[model samples]
Target chain A: MDGMVLVITSGKGGVGKTTTVANIGAALAALGRRVVLVDADIGLRNLDVVMGLENRIVYDIVNVMENKDLPVRKALIKDKRVESLFLLPAAQTRDKDAIKPEQMKELCEELRQEFDYVLIDCPAGIEQGFRNAVAGADLALIVTTPEVSAVRDADRIIGLVEAEGLRGPRLILNRLRPDMVKRREMMDIEDVLDILHIDLLGVVPDDEAIIISTNKGEPIAFDNNSKAGQAYRNIARRLEGEEVPFQSFDNPSFFQRLRQLVGMDK
Target chain B: MALLDFLSRVLNRDEGSKETAKQRLQLVLVQDRASVNPHLLEELKEDLIGVISRYLEIDLSAMEINLESGGGDTVALVANIPVRQVRRSQQK
Candidate 1:
């Protein structure tokens, strides 16, 4: 079966693209799917570190392309916790110019034949890195935060994705603070979607656990307590075309709320 | 205390608040897709004045244009022209 090539990218940096890739890949694997997370950020690789597979990288997409002795299966580091999840690290030595778009597409095709979900970690900016990253993808998962600059870049990327004849990009609004938005101090979810005008994949709340997970090389999805982690899991489900109810991040106290029934004398 | 809380609740509540994220997102995206900043937009208006005045009698002072964000309050473009006043004077 042909695999789904979903490139997780945001044109602007530091908006949690790699984090989303790590967590979503982990979540998908936990759901019993064979998923391979490819780090296409070349020379600026970080997905491996985010996925906690940094110390295990021997070969990468570059190696596979250069006809090196390293086997594709060997380059793929399997997660011990999630049996089906694997990571193909980016080459730290090579630049984005080293690879072409067609080569990236061919690499994805080869991986597609073997895996179920091929998630690509695209580098930031609309340069060769961005072009090479989305070359092989069937769908693009545009990640953005509540901030304006990131949203702007995400818009440009989505337009480019559509121009490439790919489907209209799906959105993952990461690191959102509902409380701040409720205070009118920050932009809320509706304001974001109204501009992008794409179907919402999921909303990830701003949570410190994501940072802790990154430091430990653990994906936030495994925690299940942090809001961001839960968001990533829901995103994984939505990507699988499952109907998942989005939690009201603005009202986290609602779940704990059970209205008291006051007695009315008849 | 109850009154204070109630007042805060009533005055601070945003009925259409749920749509804020989507609303702000749309405005940013439009600017992003266009690659044209507000300053550049002003420059375009100024340049248009030079091009437009060559043949047509247009209102140079009454042109008002802005980037839109849709929560329906002030999301659409508002443009005014002085053609009506000029035409009325001509008719008189």
Candidate 2:
């Protein structure tokens, strides 16, 4: 597990994989560890925008692979907020075929020598983009919502990740509502776990602050004040193999008490 | 009984309220990932009945086959393929 290469992927789109990469990278960097966030999305890259470094992108992953003259340090985009944080952007103009899996593995190896953590922001869909993104990764982080579709896609991705000779594709149940799970109107957290059966990393309660931060191109994890932000930070700590207890959603309605009484049903 | 107890606590904590739209969306997603349409499962049941009854003397009406969503990667098939010997009385 030394010099970890982690890929954040979900077969389904819009499950917040890029957002996780941005926030986790920021949090890890803030902890004084050298971190590189690699956007493997290629043409559909958004990690640059999420990290508010879209304008600074001159050379991308493709450029570094093709342009032998460009140095790795030059392609690394250091986060304005954190000194240890950096990003290797995807080529927005070219397609996912821009880089091969072997090249990605080489890049990750080069990055592993310099950075403590290399987090790949994987693109959705199980095609070439996914193959390239997961090529050099030591671990996989499956991002899903409490919903069934995301979980299903996550499950599919989990199989693929395992098939590729990887390990520990932990679950991050995002956009969960504690209030909804209590009412038996939505699938409980337990139900989702039963279906996917992966080790739980952390749960992110859906908050409006995530949208606000996304719009501002400032990651919520940098805020350190929002609940969702805390969730992401906690996940980062967990990724570093630290044991952090989860915070409850703080719903004390009669039914929530009952759900707890019954054994945390969802 | 444990599941029932757990659900009761969930209901009691949330004041017996129903699920929100987002939750329903998630549930639908899970079903979709399994490629399981309830209608499709029913059709499969009917077709399985026809195929199994064509030659065998088994109780087709008692047959049961289920498709479960195995997380996100697989479509697990759980089938109860019961068979019985063909008695000579029906051979004509």
Candidate 3:
């Protein structure tokens, strides 16, 4: 089957790159698509723990890379909760230098033949790990928060990603506090889009449910009640070529609504 | 008293942290994204001085060249060169 290889990356750490990979992979699998989450973080691998598949990793992507005879299927650990979802754990004992970009490209070519979507969780920083992650990908999804440092790094990453021939990378603004945005204490969606100048895939509100889900080794996308989960689901649908309207995070006041109705609000 | 407080809060909303963050980010990114090589700029400056010296004498010490963000995706190459004097003869 022809598959899309998407690298979920952020130049800055703690921006939810792995979380996006897990949720988007799980969401895609729930939609009956065969999905595999590849943790490209190498020594600092945590996607397995986040996906609750830490105990199931007998072999990892490194094993497949070293042993050319080893089938890629043997290294893949199937997700317990979601059908058609799999995880290719990164090697915790090794570092980013263990794998080459060419090997990653070959591995992705092999994976795309079997899975519908191959979502790679890129490590933070513009080092070798970042290059290896994007080396095999057809598209990129940049993750960033509504912060100064994160946006600046993202701008640098955008230039680097383009230099590597990956064009039109989409942005995923994560951990946005709607209440803060409403109070003008946090940057709004428009403010971020203006600086980044990339097409936004989706916006995930800062929800406590995400923390709880991480603690439970579960993705929020499985929960129907969580707004963040709904956002992930919407992003999944959008990835499937579906046009979905973004969810409004602001709880507009009566006067604000009236202003909007009268086209008086910017 | 409560009504007055609410009005004050609404009126001061524009001076919130959001605007500060956006402005700061924009300024920082302008420098970060302006990865134009200093060596290239120097070479360009030399070429510019050589060409302009034929028609007008410009001070080399006072020249300032930089790449500034014109908001969004555009970047402006700003050059400030002090003209010392104009040559009287037209150079072929």
Predicted structure with the largest lDDT when compared to the true one: 3
Best by DockQ: 3
lDDT of 2 by residue, A58-147 (tens): 788999999889988899888888889999999889998889999999999999999999999999999999999999999998999876
Ranking by TM-score: 3, 1, 2
- TM-score for candidate 2, residues paired by index: 0.74
The chain A TM-scores for the candidates, taken one by one, are 0.94, 0.93, 0.94
Off by more than 4 A, model 3: A252-266, B1-14, B36-64, B67-92
Worst 10 residues of 2 chain A by lDDT: A179-188
Cα lDDT, all candidates: 0.81, 0.83, 0.91
The alpha-carbon root-mean-square deviation between model 2 and the true structure, to one decimal in Å, is 8.8
- Off by more than 4 A, model 2: A251-266, B1-92
Q: Write the per-residue lDDT of candidate 3 for residues B38-71, one digit (tens) a residue.
A: 5667787889888999999899999988888777
iRMSD for every model: 4.2, 5.1, 0.7
After aligning candidate 1 to the native by TM-score, how far in Å is the CA of A90 from where it should be?
0.5
